[model samples]
Target: MASGDEPSGELASSLRAIGARYQELSQFPTVTHAALGAGHATSAGGQTFPLYTECSQPDLARRRRLRFSRHYSVHRSPGSAVSVSRAALSAEIHHQLLGQLSPTGQHRAVLTRCPGLGHELLEVWGSTGRSCSVDLTALGKHGEVYKEGPFACLTWSHAEKQLLYVAEKSQPRPQPLFSWDAPGAARPAEEEEEEKGEQFLYHEDWGEALSTCSMPVLCVLDIEESSVTVLEGVPEDVSPGQALWSPDDSGVVFVGWWHAPFRLGLSACSNRRSGIFYLDLSNGRCELLSAEHRAACSPRLSPDGRRLLYLEGAVGGPHRQCLQLRMITWHTRLTATVLDVVQEPTDAFAGIYTDALPPQCWAADSRRALLSTPQRSRTDLLLVDTEAATVMNLTAGLPEGCWVLLTTQWDLLVATCSAPHQPPSLVVGVLPPAGQELTLHWVRAEDAPPVPGVSWKTLTVQVPCGEQSPPPCGTRAFEAVLLSPPAGAALHPLVVCPHGGPHSVFDARWRPTTAALCQLGFAVLMVNYRGSLGFGQAGIDSLLSRVGEQDVTDTQLAAERALESEPLDRRRVALLGGSHGAFIALHLLARHPEHYQACAVRSPVTNLATLLGTSDIPDWRYAALGLPYSFERVPRAEDLAAMLLRSPIAQAPRVRAPVLLCVGARDRRVCPTQALEFYRVLRARGVPVRLLWYPEGNHALSGVETEADVFGNCARWIIRHLGQPCRAAPGQHSP
Candidate 1:
């Protein structure tokens, strides 16, 4: 405790050892030979310092008895034998201690970070006269007032002084006391800051979690002043999103919520019911603008501000799932009319559907709205005329093997065309006046990768409509995109790769993974099974409660159709899928074990009962299990039992195919445990199974490295197991 003593660490450890021995010897007063206790030295000065304060009896009682170390030779009557060594800090020093302590290459930061595009904040990416330029003034500097993550409800005041956007609730909130780099006064550690407990939600449905009815706090960032202010008037229980300023700039309108009372697990719910609400920024009074009878989303005011355009769909489903476009007279009074409702999936471009929901845009004239609609197999750019009650397919001629993602200028269309044969390329186009068959004239704004040396075709399979035998789902036709190997002399092995989402679509866009499989000499059948988009809402609704039965039959019918139609090798058919598609693959194998030679699935949903408790989307179980879920609370035990009855595991006993389960350790949607549990059961039942767990992956396993591993390993697994007769796990083989 001397003023010049800076406290030696080696001396400290040696002193603690001696004191521990003294405490142990004190337990037995009868045996006392040496005066055992600690002595501290002033480092390498060779001078020992006496203990400054009386050691607490409690401290001595709790300290463990000292033992001889393997590293040191403990001699009787030893003076300090502890060695002083400098601590290793750098990563290189740690590497010298072990073999796998270094990275393969240096970590690089983004030198040219893509300054994302937005309308309310800045008008940058395009121009009228010369070459397009970007305004990077606001890049990388928004953190002064705003935190990270996607910004919702982006808008600017008519005067352009203030900007508004909704941000997520930042957790653990950086602290100075826990930080060693900075100095600060003292404060108690937050429970949230504890190691390895709660992590920030980074799931796909995080938007619902972070900005729900009870949360979605609108933030006003002052551009000139560099300050943030939380906007009031948004009701605490009514979560607001997709906000925009009114014509007079006196009010804010947004998609508003008043759904379930609780907030837990809202992120992955079907989240359908909502209505438009307006907040008068003047007096901070909020009022509902649209009726709550049906769900609606993407509320947008026209450029002339005369009318509003929005999407309406079934309640307790996606607000735009039905894909009906509606318009409301805004200025005079609020009167709503359906501009487009999906009555049929025929000639009319009545309902909209896309790979994911595309952004709705207003034409410069403000009468017609431009958007994308998913027709049976391909997604087409469509123009909806609200006043005329007619919809026109603007980019219908984009072709079957190609898909165009549209972005619009005030008048021209800026798009990126992605085809199975080539990489995506940016192009500019026009709608061509007066409809002499409006062709999307491409102006080649950016280059594309050379066209692939392969052939592609589309197949329309007549699938049964009913989940039940009498055909509750009827015999309806669905499409599949077939990618053929480069040189097809002999018949190729058929790979049935069904698209997932149960509500999603596989567009005719360039997918390297699928192309890679085809390049490896497999004829990949990318089946758009029942319950997929592009087909109307009826087709999707058909497979809802009948997840296992309908989708399974559809795949079988599709594969049969493929054999009848394409030059596919009958004995070499395999199944490949992920998520819901994986669910289909596993269930198909369980129900009809001999249906495929082998199967590969990634992050599969094997058991609804198992997933109901752990998954982010519990409603998915009830919905898929033919039970009604209100999204308010956990499903009952009886409900779960019924769910388990329909689970793929129920029929897992019939599985005869060699199965490979691809699991993502960090998957939050379909937790990795789901795949592990499935794998264990299959192995126990003597089914041939293998697991490929990706530690750095999520529900998608979508990183470049993970994706590459998936494609390579997947191809290898299918190829290796393709012709091997049903081989159960060892020790259980039949004679």
Candidate 2:
């Protein structure tokens, strides 16, 4: 045996440092936290339960989940309406969660797990309304959830004893920084003065891309044994997402994603294809359902096993208002049902739902269904009459700021409700039977944090119509909400905010940042531009191929219209946005240079042409740049040329507004290189620009401390650029 007589303390120190880094990476599990319980009216002895999860942060860096169960008895109304407020509700966020009641209502099952993050554990519970406590520690590798897959979720079996979920087996390992085997001839360099420094091309596309070696598989965890079984027959090439067992638990239906020879970066794009696949448990064979030439996801099987409901759309497509949620007959005994919506709406399916929409209990006839939708910039419950082929708004009388999170057993609705001056509160409302009117029973959570005093009102901004003539294309109108601080001696600075997705909307939901800004004496105009959802198809269609141009005009006109009514300082106006919202902010400042003073953007898309090659949503450039996106191929040179012309980078030289860029170093959807390039260009030109780097941040740049830094800097930056920071109490406006 050979031995080193002398100890090398230096080598030991280096080895320990590497081990510490590995441990830190391992601890970053994709864990979701939660708290609270929701309930609804239920039948005698046979009741339904709504489980709530809360993330209790003992430290800014670590999080844990706590579960709550509140039962609503069908025989009686629990209490007089329990009124909940908004400011108190917005602080709760949980990871992918599933909650339901057992057949006898004697027990309930709640499952919660975090996605994309590593080392986090899934929290499971079996409660009986009175007592249910199971220690979830010291579980072996069979129960661990890691970070390599495209998606993961936790659900309960029909019997409520076994847990079924989508799991990815391959553990992600650290890859080498660069490939070392390549050898190429060097080109002769021109004099630095003669050459324009060869524009620094970018190649940061893969940071957010899925690892090639990883794939998703369906797995079942036995609650009693704590052992796992990877389902057989799942293809190596197909990665599955969000799945559910058939009503009888005889089959598993899930979303299947097949990769092409070439991969797109993380920015969600319409060109990627997905379909619904079903695995017959008896035979262990997987078969493709409909969804060809369409991206399908979030499949739900009716309890009676008579029908299936799922969403079909170009998820990242420009048709902001066109995603559809359709229902198909599921009688295998008869012929396979054709693709069709049991009830199709005149307007495109809208609101925030793919997987977020909770499956409601089937009507007594087992035909009609209940669900929530985003309509007219507000979240509402819609009861779908499958046979009648019509949709009804159950909560039509609810206030404007009402946003539904998800529904629970026996028609219990969980939502966030608020009015201009009211802070958001956790709302628990009961839905009356079909023919009767709907009323809400709410609960006011104690020890809730206070929201800043702010008042809001709805307003519409009108922009010019058609092209050449007086009646070529009609004028379009957009709706927005004006949020303001208490009246002061002088008018406050106006900050125009835009929503991302380019296709998304700025709805009545309570935004903590918006309230914070109002507290600092600012008037905020949140624009629901032409491309926003909730409007009719005509409104969303107007922005199809007119992204940079039409969206820019809409934002500018909305800002001008808002200033007309609000008492805001015209000279002290500022612009803010993230993602595509940031794209609009930058272009507005460049095209109409004097329209705003300073601009602040987080993860803004600077160059569309560059993004075509480096962004996770590679096809996004083609679609947003006015060309149809091809599912399997990257855009050609001509398509890229058009993108370059439409990007904000083309007008960067015209921007005179001082700019601040916030970036996440670990973002996969939109890389940080875009910001680096923008920062470099501005610095080189001697323009006023600042860049803030979040070393371990992702696309949102979020964390307890990181978010505070990002939003705090945002408000402070605007105040500094606008004029002065005022700190007088409400009604004590600065003189």
Worst 10 residues of 2 by lDDT: 22-31
Per-residue lDDT tens digits of candidate 2, residues 1-735? 111123246434433433332222222111122222334444543333433433223122442232223222222245333333322332444553444444434444544453553333444444523233222222322334423333555656777666666645533232334424457745334324433333443322223534332456677766666666778876555667677777777878887766554445422332246677888989989887756666666676666778876666654455333445566677662223222321222443333332334544354345666665556456666666666655666656556465454444444445545544444444455555655534444454322233444778778776665532221143266778788877877877899987787877777765656765665567888888876766654565567678888787778878888777778788888999998889899899889888798889999988888877666666667767657776666568887788878888888888888888998887776778988887787777777788889897777776656765677566555655675534322321110
After superposition, the stretches of candidate 1 with alpha carbons farther than 4 Å from their true spots are 1-153, 169-214, 264-270, 317-320, 354-360, 400-405, 434-440, 447-450, 464-475, 631-638, 723-735
Task: For candidate 2, report its TM-score.
Answer: 0.77
Q: How close is candidate 1 to the true structure, as a TM-score?
A: 0.71
RMSD of 2: 12.4
TM-score of each: 0.71, 0.77
lDDT of 1 by residue, 1-735 (tens): 001133256434433433332232222211100011122335454322111100111123333322111111111112322222112221111101001000111111011223354212322111142121222234332222212222254555555545555544333444333345446755455534543333443323332223222255665545456555656887766656677677777787777655455333333233455677888888999887777665666776776788888776666543125566767798765665655445347755536763222332666677766776677777677776778777787656555344444433234454455666455554444444434326545555334554344468778887544435433333276788888765455677888988777777777766656655665567888888877777777776667667787777778888888888787788889999998899889888877676688899998988888887777656667766556777565667798788777777777888888888888887767778878888888888777788898887777776545665566556656766663212111111110
Cα RMSDs, all models: 24.0, 12.4
How far out, in Å, is residue 36 in model 1?
83
User: How many residue pairs collide in each prediction?
Assistant: 9, 24
Q: Which residue ranges in model 2 land beyond 4 Å of their true spot?
A: 1-75, 78-150, 171-213, 224-226, 262-272, 314-316, 319-321, 333-355, 359-365, 419-421, 438-452, 466-475, 631-635, 725-735
